[model samples]
Target chain A: MRTFEHVNAPDVQTAVALLGEASTEAIAGGTDLLGELKARLRSPQRLVNLKTLAGLQEISYSPKAGLRLGALVTLAEIERHPIIQERFPILAQAAASAATPQLRNMGTIGGNLCQKPRCWYYRNKLFECWLKGGDKCFAEDGENKYHAILGADRCHAVHPSDLAPALIALDATLRVVGPDLDGELSLEELYTKPTESRRQMTILGPGELITDIRVPIPKNGSRGVYLKTMERQSWSFALVSVAAQMNFAGERIADARVVLGGVAAIPWRARDSERILIGQRFSEGLAERAVEAAVAGAQPLRDNEYKVSLAKALVKRVIIDLCSTTD
Target chain B: MATKAVRAKKLKVAIRGPGKTAIKLTVNGETHELLIEPRRTLLNALRKDLGLTGTKKACDEGTCGTCTVLLEGKPIYACMALAIECDGKSVETIESLSKDGQLHPIQRAFIAEDALQCGFCTPGQIMSVKALLDENPNPTLDDVKRVLSGNLCRCGAYPKLFQAALRAADLVRTGR
Candidate 1:
């Protein structure tokens, strides 16, 4: 690991001031940042520690505001929270399926959402691909097995978060705090198109920090589910995952949101499939149609042709499972 | 000579890697205060700084759990944790399990079951199993497999190790 200054900040104001001074990075729980630093992927001048900051490890809910998840709240806490388990079981299920029990105990929600890609080329510091601001994207032709099938232009890397798909499916909003102002923004707006900036992720600026994630409670008769298919059962990233949440009136779907993970540069929201599902009765044929619409026009690389089929199969499976689930 | 005296002038300098930070950690009911570099991992601090060498280091990249230790009664890969970050926490290694030359029940069970061939990964496996049993004493076979999946043994003693864990749980339940 490289030599860097470590400053523990007791409050967000002081942490923001420290970040404003130089090339400083915030460290919450240090589960992801420390691993990146050790791999020589990041070399910051200073590390601003946020563990000492009070009131940031909260997982509280309000009748008016719904669920408020603090940045410092660990994945284990979210999985174990009673309100989250009752109201948003999909979010809890997603949290429970990530990494191992030990990693979940140490990894915070903010770190999981803001983590860098797990691509072997991007993580290996020696390879300067397009995502790393270089000209060539190595995954375009070379070893493109895990590359994106959707939203692939300059870069084809896949989004690795299991939580983002669930959060976006629930129509969540993020509360961002920056040097200028603080406000709420939808999770869909947090992601940017791959063509816009190949190097940057969310629309968050340099000095902005994610303070909390607020998920609105669904109306009555709403059901949600998150399902992930990975090569290994534990301690591995997902190959394909689907998050489905729908509001049902009798046997027909009223409103629905479907987000696919591990298949695109961002949380790939299945807008066409969602539109098809609305005002339609839940059945095997309906799910098959939604899956076909969701995966249409997919552009798969040489080695990742199976992802298109795998993604379609997962979407159909998850939708059928959700339809079978009772409130 | 005057030249010799001038050449002997003291030059106070500090040459350290990333500067040394004082961290106080408790292990096995003993508190140790030591100066460690910022980049020093908990595995290095345990074996090199504090001389508690029970925790083994294998696949330092966090894949293998040979460096597993209990931090606040939860098993974590020591190689992935920085020593400086655990300044005010409690750590438990395999060395702290026995009392007064008496083997812990888990150790006795492992011996009785002949759970070791080379014994290289024993400490970490024991620590992981201990942490799991502490939390869930009567864990099912599936639970045991899930919790101990992180730790690996090259000797392929997983079956015997599983028996040892089950025996240890029985001992804990029966007060044998």
Candidate 2:
């Protein structure tokens, strides 16, 4: 890893100020950042340690206030929290299925949400892909099995977070602190498609830091489920994951949100699928129609055509399972 | 609480240098002061500065659990952690499990069950199991499998390893 100066930020203000320096990055869990540094994908001049900042590790919840998760709360904590498991089961399941027990124990919520793409070409320092300011994406033509099937503008690399899809399904918002910006944005706004003007995945400013995540309270008779398919049983990134949350009025679905991961540059919200399910009676036929609508416009790459079917199957299974559950 | 306040005060003194910084680490109930660059990993500091090589290093990235250790009672990858970030923190390594030359129960179970073949991944596997058993004394088979999934055993001793973990749990319950 390239040598750099390290500073322990005393508070959020200090951490944001330290990040204002050129070529400086914040280190929360260091699980992803350390790997990038070792692979020479990034070489910042300074690292601002966010662990020293107080009060960023708390996880609080209330029936009226919903859930408030600090940026420093580890994935392990989220996976085991009783309130999270009971109130927002999709988040718990997503957290449990991510990485491994050890990595989850150290990786924080903020770091996980802001993690870079896991594209092998982008990760390999030798290949200067388009995301890294090169001519073109190598994965577009070569070894594109794991590339995105949706929202592939300039970069086809898929978003790697298992939690982002679940959080977006639950309508979570993020509170950020920066030199010029300090407010909340919907979880959907945190991500952006890679375009020629903006090559990065998120729209966060240079000195911005995520402080807290607020998940809205689940409505009455609401049910959620998160299902992920991987190459192996454990410790592998999701091949295709589906997060579904449905709010039912009596026996009819009143509202719904379905998001797909590992198939898009951002957490792909299946609005067509959600539209198909709303105000419809929960049934296998409804689930099939929703699943079909979910994968309607997917433009899979040469090697990733199988992902469309896999993603469709996952969405169908998750919707049926969630609809069958009782509140 | 007073001691914690004092330690926080001490850590508040930031290191504003353009080069290596001095920091103090508390590992295995011992405090060691070392000067290292910010990029130095906790795994390297443990092996080189403290000379505690029981923690094996593999994959250096966070993928492999060979560099697993306990940070504040939670198992984490040492290779992915910076030593400077561990200032004023407690770290438990594989070396600290045994006391007074007596093997820890988990170590004894591994030996009895022959859970290891080449033993390259033993320390990490044991540490992960120790962390699990420390929190849940009576873990179910599924719990053991889920927690140990991070520590890979290339020797394909997974069945015996699970058996050893179950045996360790039994021994703990009986106060052996």
Candidate 3:
């Protein structure tokens, strides 16, 4: 890692102020940022240590207020929290399924959501992909197996977050504070395709920092499940994952959310798939239909057409799991 | 760079180093003060400066768990943690395992179970086991596999490693 000045910011205001300067970035658990630093991918002149900020490490939940997770809360903390395990099991499952125990102890939710893509071209200093301001993206014609099948614009790198799809399915929002941005923004709104103008995945502006994640309490009789298919049982990124949340009223599904990861530039919400479930009764045939709609418009690259089928299978399994037995 | 960190309030939060700066680290119940660069990782500080090299540095990045250590009683990759960030925090490394020349229970169990080959990954593997048994005295086989999955042993002594973890649990329980 390059030698740099470290500032342990005493408050959010101070951290934001420090990040406002050029070539300065915020360090939260350093699980992701430190790797990027050591690999010489991004060398900031100064680092503002967000760990010193007060009140960012607490997790509190109430029936009326839902859940409020401080940005600094580690993934293990989220995975092991009693309320999260009992009430928001999908989020807990997602956290537990992510990286190993050592990493979960060190990685924070904010860092997980903000971590860089695992694209080989992007991480290697040898290739200057378009995401790094190059003329073209090598993943387009090269080893494109892990690239996105849906929402493949200029960059084809898939979003590598496990918590993102789960949280987005639960309709989570984030409170922000910064010199350029402040207010609450939905978790889905945080991700955007990397455009030529802004070659970054997230829409966060300079000095913007995520303060807290707010999840609305699920309505009664709601079922949520997160299913991920990886090459290995553990320590592997999801080849295709699905997060399905639905509220059952009597025999009909009142509301539904189906989000897909590892198939898009962002946590791709399957609204068409969700529409097939909501306002309808669960049936064996209905699950197949929802699964079909989930991957209807996917444009897979040469080596990644298998993800299309994998994604459909995962979505169907999740829908079936959520609607297996109605109370 | 120094001027950017100055603020009207919170004067106690000083900007430390583009160079060496003073910091305190508590390792194995002993506190030591040293001057180090802010970029110095805890792994290097333990092995080089403090002369405590029990924590191996196999894959320095977070992928390999050779440098695993307990910070505030939670297992974290020492390589991923900065020494400056560990100020006033307690770090428990592999060197702290034995007491008064008697090998720790986990170490003794590993030897009894013949759980090592090259022994390059033993210290880290033992530290992870110590962490697990500290929380869960009687872990199932699934729990043992999942926790030891991060610490890769190229020699593939996984069967014995599993036995060692279970044996270490028995040793602790029986006060051996």
Candidate 4:
């Protein structure tokens, strides 16, 4: 409940300029930032509101320009958009399955992508985990049944978004804007590990803002699916999730993008699984092999040994279900 | 020395606007003006600021639906919403459902079915049921379950809740 200055930015440029000149932070829907500020995880001298900016709320599609999802597009809009559901069912499924109806109505796609991690220790502010610039990770030795099982060195927290792994599988690109600067980068290049830098998880520079996310029109004969396993049927993060996209030619997998969530420091992509399915037909056996390959190099901590097995099982289920999908 | 210097050089910026922001909102049907800080959540501003304590604040991080309220006729988590953001919108809390001390149809149905145990989650459940009935006057048992999944009753009153919602739907359809 601390006092902080608030300013409403009417445009991206003005918002960026405001951020550059003062100790400011952006507030899109305030679903995440306000909570974080209240928890004292972040202390900004000023809050730059992004809700008034026009044209940042549209969800547009083109055969040429692909799908352009603006920064302020709510999760409900993404979930219910006909074109998104038809063309990119993976994204739609991930969006529709997030949090709950009320959260989906208020949470913006940009905020969901840019929101901080949901690690219990990190949010509590009392544990001082390694991801929070502290020397130790409490989840490393504590109750880590939800921690990562892949791609962990010094930190083992899993990526919290169910949409992020699906977006990675769709080969989406991100467009970021800041003061006098604008650029686009693939979604793969957007995330980095805590081992790489303890300070930030994304490649966005300090004043940079995510403006839009674009997904190229995938070629014909492409099919994708997102499957998640949670302890509860609703209102909980995934215990393990998989986003599988299979490009097939006469039942043989021509191309595949297999990304694993709830099991890594980043959205872990299983390149080995992709390599194994290059010419092989996707069956229950092949799916099992892919799952084995997906969790091949996992080094589970003391309390998170079950994540590796759970991740393998979810990946196998997703691939099996995806193979059953028709063009 | 360093802390004192930092505090001395800091500008006196009013975090909220000059004085508390006066937000004029129409709750249910009545208009009211309330002074709230920029950081106060809509749930707090409604309950603490205006003394409308019908909207509960359980699991304030948007997980539980105890604080569910209608913003311009759409259900949203009141805790995650800012007070200033509701300036010109119509907010409907649980207290607004009763007309001249008569319980709303959903509230009456809930009581008739004994759908509440401790009654902590009753208001949110009733508000959500109101929204569901507003959209779909005749909802199936599955539809009622889908809409009420976000509202959790620790006492396990879901069977009664489902029955009450079904009964409310029937009443709304039959005009009884």
Candidate 5:
């Protein structure tokens, strides 16, 4: 890792002010940022440590106000919280399926949401992909198995967070704090594609920090499920994952939110699939149709065509599993 | 909103600028003070500065759990953690498990079941298991598998390791 100054911020405002300095980055859990620094992907002059900041480690919940998760809450806490496991099973399942026990204990939820892509090509310092200000994306033509199938224009690297898809499916909102930008935005707004001027995954401005995440209370008759498939049994990134939340009126679906991960630059919200499921009676055949609509416009690369089918299958499985459960 | 008010209080911030800083860490119930660069990892500090070589460092990255240690009683990869960030924090390594030269129950179980082949990953695997068994005395088979997933055993002693973990749980529960 490159040599740099380290400062423990007293609070959020000081943290934001320190990050506004030249070539400075925020360090929360240091699981992803430290790895990036060691790999020479990023060489910041200073690191503003956010672990010392108070009031960002609490996890509170209420039936009226829903769930409020401080940015510094570790993934292990989420996986073990009784309220999350019972009320928001999808989020708990996503947290449990991520990385491993040791990493989960070290990785915070806010850091997990802002994690960089896991593409081998992007991670390697030899090849600077378009996202890294290079000419072309090496994954576009070589070793593109783990690349994205959706929202892949300038970059084909897929988003690696398992929690982001589940949180988006739950309609979570993030409280962001910065020098001039301090407000709440839906979780979906946190992600963006690589545009002409912006070659990043998220639209977070420099010096901005995610303070906390707010998840809305599930409807009276709603339930959610998360399903992920990996190359091995454990400790591997998701090959394809689906998070499905459905509101049912008796035996018919009233509302649905379906999101796919490991198949897009962002957590790909399956609006078409959601549209197909609402107001329809839950059945195996309907799930198949919804899965078809979910993968309608996927443009898979040469080595990732199997992801489309895998994502579709996971979508179907999650929807079916959610419908089969009673509450 | 509440954080804004707290920010206005002008809290004394600990800023370690452009130079080495003195950091105090509590390792294995002993306090140690060291002056080091901010870029130094806790794993290196433990091995070099504190002379605690029981904790192995296989993959410097967070992937391999060979550097597993307990930070505030939660298992975390030491290689991924900065020594400066560990100021005033308690860290328990593999060296702290045994007391008065008597092997810990988990250590005894590992020896009895022959869970280790080459023993390169034994320290890390033992630390992870110790953390799990510390929290959950009666861990299920799935719990053992999930907790040790990060610790890679190239010797492929997973079945024997699993048996040892179960045996350790039984021994601890019965006070054997």
Candidate 6:
């Protein structure tokens, strides 16, 4: 790892100010930043330790106000929080399905959302892919198994977070703090397609950081499910994951949210699937139609054709599981 | 709580540099003050500065759990953690599990179950089991698998490892 200065920010104000400096980066849990540093992918002159900040360290909830999580809350805490597990279990399931226990203990919710792409070409220092301000993306035609199938622009790297799909399905909002931006923004707005001008996954400008994450409590009789497929049973990134949440009014569906990961540059919201699910009761035929709509316009790469069928199957399974859930 | 209306003007943080800086680490209930660079990982500081090599380092990235250690009683990857960041926090490594001459129950169970082929991953595996049994005294088979999934035993001693974890839970429950 390249040597750099480390600063313990006394408050969010100081953290923002220091991060605004050139060749400086923020380190929350260091699970993601340390790896990038070790791989020499991001060589910063200074590291502002966000853990030293006075706030962004608590998980609070209320019946009327819903659940609010500080940015520094570890993934393990989310996986084990009683209120979260009992109320929004799909979020907990997504947190639990992430990296191993060790990484979960060290990885914070904010850092997980802002972590860089896991593309082989992007991570390898040898390949200056388009995301790195290069002319072309190597994953376009080379070893493109994990490339994007939807919303691929200059880069095809998929969003590698499991919590993103789940939280977006839950309609979570974030409180961002920065120089020009300090307000509530939908979690979906945090992401962006890798355009020639942006060349990044998120819209966070210089020194922008998330302070709080709020997930609204679902209405009564609502059920949500997060299902992921990996190469192995455990300790692997998602091959294709689905997060589906449905709100029920008596016997009919009032509203629904369906999001897919590992299929697009951002958390792919399956609005077509959700549209099919709204105002309809859960049934095998409805599930089939929704699943078909989820992958209608997918453009899989040469080596990633399996993701299309796998994503469709997971969408069907997630909807079924959400309707069948008793608790 | 800080108000959102407060604008970030200039930083008041005392910065430690690209050069060596002073920091203190509490390892195994002992505190040591040393000067080191900011990039020094907890795994390297423990092995080199503190001479506590019980914690192994493999896949220096977070992929492998060979460098697992307890930060504030929660298991985390040491290699992924910066030593400077753990200034006032407590760290429990594999060396701290046993005291005097008596082996920890998890270590004894690993020996009894013969959970080793090359023994390269034993320290990490045992530490993970210790962490699990510390939190859940009566861990089920699935719990054991979930906690130890991070610590990979390339020698393929998983079957015996599960048995050893169960046996360790029993040994601790029986107070033997």
Q: Against the true structure, what is every candidate's RMSD?
A: 6.1, 4.3, 1.6, 3.4, 3.4, 3.3
Per-candidate TM-scores read: 0.92, 0.96, 0.97, 0.93, 0.96, 0.97
Flag clash pairs in model 2. Answer: none
Q: Model 1, stretches more than 4 Å misplaced?
A: A194-198, B1-17, B114-118, B154-156
Clashing pairs in 4: A4-B15, A5-B15
lDDT of 2 by residue, B25-125 (tens): 88999988988778789999999989999999989998778899998998999999998888778999999989999999999999999999999899999
Q: Name the better of 1 and 5 by lDDT.
A: 5
Model 1, range B1-176, lDDT digits (tens) per residue?
Answer: 23322322221111123578788999888899989876788889999998888899877777778888999988888887778778889999999989899998999999999998999899988887898889888988787777777787889998999988888888877877
lDDT (10s digit) by residue, model 5, range A189-259: 99998776988889998889999999999998888988999998889899989988889998899899999
Q: Which ranking of candidates, highest TM-score first?
A: 3, 6, 5, 2, 4, 1
For candidate 6, what is the DockQ?
Answer: 0.58
Question: What value does the lDDT take at residue A97 in candidate 1?
Answer: 87
Candidate 2's DockQ is: 0.46
DockQ top scorer: 3
What is the C-alpha DockQ of each candidate? 0.19, 0.46, 0.70, 0.41, 0.54, 0.58
In model 2, where do residues sit more than 4 Å from their true spots? Answer: B1-13, B16-18
Give residue A206's error in model 2 in angstroms. Answer: 0.3
Q: Which stretches of candidate 4 lie over 4 Å from their true place?
A: A196-198, B1-19
Stronger candidate by DockQ (4 vs 6): 6
Candidate 3 per-residue lDDT over residues A142-235, each given as its tens digit: 9999889997889999999999999999999999898866799999999999998998889888889999999999899998999988887888
Candidate fnat values, all: 0.16, 0.76, 0.80, 0.47, 0.80, 0.91
CA lDDT of every candidate: 0.82, 0.90, 0.90, 0.82, 0.91, 0.89
Instruction: State how far residue B32 of model 5 sits from its true place (Å).
Output: 0.5
Can you tell me which runs of candidate 6 are displaced by over 4 Å? A325-327, B1-10
| Residues A171-269, model 1: lDDT tens digits | 999988888868989988988755536476677766678888989988888989898888877777778889989988888889999999998888899
Task: Give the Å error, residue A298, model 5.
Answer: 1.2
